[model samples]
Target chain A: MNTETIQSAIHPNQNHPNRNRPPLCFVRHAVWPPPRWGIALETPPGVGMKNWSNEFIGVDWGTTNLRAYRIGCDGGIQESFEDVLGVSAVSDGNFAGIVRELRETLGNLPMLLSGMIGSSIGWRTTPYVAAPASLEDIAAKITWVEPRWTGLLPGISVLTNSRADVMRGEEVQLLGYQSEHGLTQYTICHPGTHTKWAKVRGGKVEDFRSVMTGEQFSLLKEHSLLKAMMHGRVEPDRSFLEAVETGWSGVELTAELFTVRANVLLSRLPECRAASTVSGLLIGMDLRTGLRLAGHDLIVVLGDPALVRLYTAAIEHIGKDCEPAEGATAFVAGMTRIKEMIQ
Target chain B: MNTETIQSAIHPNQNHPNRNRPPLCFVRHAVWPPPRWGIALETPPGVGMKNWSNEFIGVDWGTTNLRAYRIGCDGGIQESFEDVLGVSAVSDGNFAGIVRELRETLGNLPMLLSGMIGSSIGWRTTPYVAAPASLEDIAAKITWVEPRWTGLLPGISVLTNSRADVMRGEEVQLLGYQSEHGLTQYTICHPGTHTKWAKVRGGKVEDFRSVMTGEQFSLLKEHSLLKAMMHGRVEPDRSFLEAVETGWSGVELTAELFTVRANVLLSRLPECRAASTVSGLLIGMDLRTGLRLAGHDLIVVLGDPALVRLYTAAIEHIGKDCEPAEGATAFVAGMTRIKEMIQ
Candidate 1:
């Protein structure tokens, strides 16, 4: 890591015995105004870091949020930084500039990048390699950041005779999960703007589906006709079952949608009851679609703890079993496991 | 009828034999100039009648889209007029003047008022009387337009043991429906800005519901997050069923609504598809709830032809049945039935 990052990370309390000599050991801290921003502001790159070695700092280049972690030789964080730089920057015409900032901040350190950085808009499309091959196989062929920093982590393509799908950072998370749990296979779901439900067998994410259900849900309640019938948040109700029942009945959704707002306005139906109705419709459909492909009982979910909780509840309500797998911790753990195989 | 309205409606087609003016009629019509500027042109009341001895007319006042019928001795219309005097004047805070103009044009003849005219913002808030009554019940309580038109039929109301819902012109439609069908029991759905679904048994509306689906749909799709996701008319696979499906499946419509435009950017779920998805969810749930009350048999839908077509397709997909009933025609039949009863 850079020297300024190093000095900021070195605790002031760690004065040397001589009181004038250089000290050792560094710790990652969430200081106000993270260290990177301060370093870029105070000492521009070349003036300092003439004293560091070549090594990676962890990078999370996601579709909507960005963050980074610096690891020392002993695998400890020297610093960490995060921003809402989101992959959306590329969609808005600023991919090259941010890459320059990343290079300047981290200096010459070889970086291990995860997430959408491997996608087409990132540094360079590094095609994803499959799993069960340790970090080296999954490692991007050659992490290349053009002068402009326009690059991406090549996404892993899961395909068979019948289906095909691609995933980026979550693949790393899966690898981290597999290497950590020591399981031959598992089912995982990462929820966000685009929720990915994947099936891992022989330690490879063999297949998956992306559902826009979450996004659709948000739009419907807050922006669509359905919103008119609601008072936003409501006390939990059993009527949620009606929603699921409606889905299973296979009633076409198009024509009937008007009734949600209508019944409530008509006062023939209670407004509060709409919450469960909306929830049941989305989760129920996704569950039905997923079960059709993944064999319901054999699958497990990996997502936000709360979302996982809700997923579990919905599954149980529909006569299925489910549980949550911590995603972030699993990511670091899975990476650590790959670190083992590499050594 | 007011003198001028009687005169304008009478015209001198005497020897031409088509002067066929009805004793009294209540159809509303208006024609507008080019460019849809909404300028209305109506013949002054009494003068036209001076030329033809036996003629009168029925007028319908709405917030927008006005119409009237020139009738024969048997209540047959020899001509008609329609335009956009609509309730915009009142909605625009010009109530008094619009009412005065309406009075001068229609004269003292009996003219019926509905829509916003009965709203607190309209001509006056004419308290509604329960259904199953006739012109006698309504015309008897005419809210006189002083210094102008005198007798105006009041609106109608649906009352249950615990609640009361009212409609003016639609009440007229219901009266028309009850009298014409020759049956005292049926379910009627009036589809418009505020769609009303009513259950009538033994000549009285026993249960009814109002859904603000249309208004909400317009506001959200045009003004909310959904604005970005939309691409003109989206016809769901099975409009109501699929929409209801989403509603019932627990899509979490409310929570996910705000994310629509963002998700559109991330999921690339196709901007065109987003609108249909929203439509599908809301309308689908409406159909589901409606089905709950419709029971398992064929439901006779009293609504617009287009809406009836949608309802028929949705219900049939769910193994239920639908019979289309023209809302306007039913109103006419109901009026005729009531007239026969009175005669």
Candidate 2:
């Protein structure tokens, strides 16, 4: 049993005994065989050992879908595919079989999976690592399942004033950002159905907060009194800007929400504008709390382009700075960094 | 050209010059035929004028239904009936015909309608009476619709810091409480889909605030993530009390809401208990904001028994006093007072 931790891929000074070994790969974004870090296989799987090359795979298995990336030995993506059978949908308990098929097709690569795959509903429930956790802390806690070919990453949990908060998958992305920019403090925001604002200090997640802004926005737009008033696309309009300012003013969100409907009924505020206004208010409120915690540090937003744009605009509106990163790209980069740590 | 308001059936000191004259009746929740105010009926229209005693009818015509209260000349509810055809349902513009049929069945009675029946979607759009408005102010603004059979009571509108707030049916109920108590200062809380807290001073609603507690609770329980955790009866339990206290602590609601789901997942909070906790949190938050604006005074809660109980429990939880009043009874009393003033 020769097991050793792989040292920092970014910093050669922070040495580990296994640092000189060829690193394991977890790929994303990059095209297949991108010469820089890609090794082309000279033979097919089960071929003669002289020509075969062992690879690594990264899986972002979330509540809605499972995305698998096959990385060449040199850390570049060779191919990628996705299965719609997310953790929530895999009811037949055939997770091993599903992974087996993929592994066979991709030459039996060693795999690391992140996101809801480790949730209670996933293949195995991996206990969360309490915050003030570094990438090494997370990588050490990875649950090596019964299947020797797979490793599952644990989610991060933070206890703020006795209120428990947890996030899966995003923790990996945060580590990726940290690996790319070493041992520095930054506010990493991953916005989606449940948006998280995490503080990274000295390459560890100090603490974070989760706001139900995205979920509430969806519920209100689809099932609330404001639903009928939401006519056009939920883009940031003039009303959206005004609402953002209103939210930033420390107003109670519940109280202010009633006024949205009242304004539509009494002031004849256009329905389309009302929808945008709601989005602005929710996003603005999240930012208000998030930015306060973030302080005057670099704020990096990772999410869909449309959502990221909204947050960026709101951030600048309040005289703050923000950088946008694609969520999928960050997920892959984060997975790659973690793979290097366990290699 | 012969137009006159109905004479007071309750006020003894306030003399109407038309007291001796035959008083035309426009009834609502109020009972009539009191010995002091009752007048002998004149000859009835058409065939034999002998046994036909024209009654006053009080119609609580709201958004969902039409509640007609037929009263004797003296001050008493003779009989009451409800029609499911609400303001929204009367799309054929047969409001007059509807009222006419009811009037004929009850002996050609004059009707006083209140609630959403006077809104833009109602039979006639009655303008709202601005707040800090007395019963007299509201009475003066009542619109006499084209249908000779009905008088629509105007809803009250309040502008708080330039935010427009309006209440149709609840205002009448608040006045009913005021008329019964004779214009003392009190905080009147009417709980429903949209809960209202009004500041009443000397027979007038000075100002008020509307909180959408009930509707939000419904949306969260049925449509949001908490829906799964919201099993069992939603009645107040120990969890409800605890949640109410949590809500009254002035925590940001949006942030706290996420915990309702997280607690069930992490802490194993009972699914049934989660429902009551959510209710308590919502009600408690409303009371916190509502009571602060209501000031230190007698709090009158007027609504359904179940809802009123929740509000009463929450109000008392904070060491405050709350008096529960049935909504229907108050509306009748309020209408009686308004009828007296107009007369």
lDDT of 1 by residue, A90-163 (tens): 45445555544555554444355678766655555676554333344664353546321222344565434433
Docking class of 1: incorrect
Q: How high is the lDDT of residue B228 in model 1?
A: 51
| Residue B332 displacement (Å), model 2 | 1.3
Pick out the ten consecutive residues of candidate 1 chain A with the lowest summed lDDT: A10-19
On a 0 to 100 scale, what is the lDDT of residue B73 in model 1?
Answer: 40
Candidate 1 positional error at B145, Å: 12
User: Chain A vs. true chain A, TM-score per candidate?
Assistant: 0.69, 0.80
Score candidate 1 by lDDT: 0.52
List residue ranges in candidate 2 displaced over 4 A.
A1-57, A64-111, A121-124, A141-146, A150-152, B1-54, B59-109, B120-125, B143-146, B232-238, B339-343
Candidate 1 lDDT score at position B27: 29
Number of the top TM-score candidate: 2
lDDT per residue as tens, model 1, B1-343: 4333533443322332223433333324332211211223443334332322233334555654454544334544444454444554334455545443443443323243445566554666776666655545764565755422333456666555534455656665665666655666666666554566666666665556555445545656665535655765655354335554555554433333433433454453456667665655655555554566455433566665766665565556556666777765554444333333322
